[model samples]
Target: MEILVCVKRVPDNEESEIEVNADGSDIQRDDLVCSTNEWDNYAVEEAIELVDEHGGNVTVVTVGDDESEEVLRRGMAMGANNGLLLMDDAFECSDGKGIATILKAAVEKGNYDLIMTGAQSDTGAGQVGGMLAAMLDYPYASLVNSVEVIDDKKLKVGREIEGGNQEMNEIDLPCVLSIQTGINEPRYVTIRGIRKVSSVEIPIQVASDLDISGDSVGAASARVKKIDYFVPELGAGAEMLEGATEEIVEKLIEMLKAKGGLK
Candidate 1:
């Protein structure tokens, strides 16, 4: 089986404050620390493990500027066979749909038996995998926590559902799976592996190379647009209730009733 894993380089939200740029088109990224999307790391690890078990190759792909290569190299260090960087000035300002379109174009250029991606990006726009699957007209499952290869052309997957339930199903090969976090612990990239992949050239693909018009990507092709961005004003602080447990409960009920929150 040949697996293709799509990864993204995203800002480390935990370590940086997100401020909208003056243009209102995107966030201010100049001071942000960028790293591979956390969930994508799990996808990469799962792909590598699958290949390790089934005897196949795993390729990692990403779409972004030069910095995006770092995420691909990280994947290679974690045992991916090769990396593909879809870099083009035309790809800037692309929305999720535009990205999925480009990824579909890239996937078409390869012979992949399985495709995996994070259930959602750091941006929380969980759209890429499903959109890419739709574009490719392939079977897809989202929020997948486990994947079992049933045969050369079939796979049984466990999808995470509400209330911690898992829905298992069998799907044919050449399908896309949106992996969820906690599926597996991602391995760290060692210094030696990093140096090794650094010398391995990563091929770049432009929009035209994928048979896509430059104008048909980026903001021009985006299905959604950001109208505004601003930090939400901090709301009122919580009020602490002081009394016995029963008294506190009674006071809470009274407050709720006064606010018309209860019968």
Candidate 2:
């Protein structure tokens, strides 16, 4: 069973900042450093676990600029057997469909048994995973918190829905899963693993090689469009209510009732 895990490089949340562009169509980048997208790291961890349990090779793939190779390397250091980098200038402005189209092409070339990705990216739209599933004509499950291989061709997955409820489903293999972050506590790359794969070659894939194009799956041809991007104005702060415990409880209850927060 050959599994392909799609990962991404994003700005570390702690040092992340969004600088609005003049057209508000994109963010202005000045000093952005790349790290693995938080949820994608969990997906890599899950893939590694599957490979460890069942004898199989795990390959980590990503679409981004050369700097994004860091994500693939990070995955290799975590236990992935190989890395594939889909790097192209045309992919820079791609929306969800375009991104998925590229990924679909890459995965098809490998004919992977299962494909996994983060439920959403930290940047742009979070629709890539579902769009990729549609392109590949694969059954998809999103926000998956846990996954267990029932057999060679089946999976038992737990997904979180609204209101803190979980939905469990038995899905067939050769499916796409958009994994949630809390699925596992991703292990950090060990110094030994890093050094071992440090000199390993990473396969680079090109859009032209895939024979896919912007006209085929670009935003212009997308079923959805982003009309605008705006940062909502930050509003007011809270008022402090200082009093005894009883007084505070009464005030909180009154406020809640006034706001219809209580029945």
Top-lDDT structure, candidate number: 1
Determine which window of 10 residues in candidate 2 has minimal summed lDDT: 217-226
Query: How many steric clashes does model 1 contain?
Result: 0
**Tens-digit lDDT string for candidate 1 (1-263):** 89999999999888898888887766898989888999999999999999999999999999999999999999999999999999888899899998998999999999999999999997798999999999999999999999999999899999999997989999998899999999998988888888889889999999888998877789888878877777666568767799999999999999999889998
Query: Any idea what lDDT model 2 has?
Result: 0.86
Stretches of candidate 2 above 4 Å error?
Answer: 21-25, 217-230, 235-263
Q: Tens-digit lDDT track for model 2 on 197-242?
A: 8888898988788887757655455666667877867557666778
lDDT of 2 at 49: 90
Off by over 4 Å in 1: 22-25, 234-263
Clashes found in each candidate (C-alpha, N, C closer than 3 A): 0, 0
Model 2 residue 140 lDDT? Answer: 94
- Winner by TM-score: 1
Error of 1 at 185 (Å): 1.1
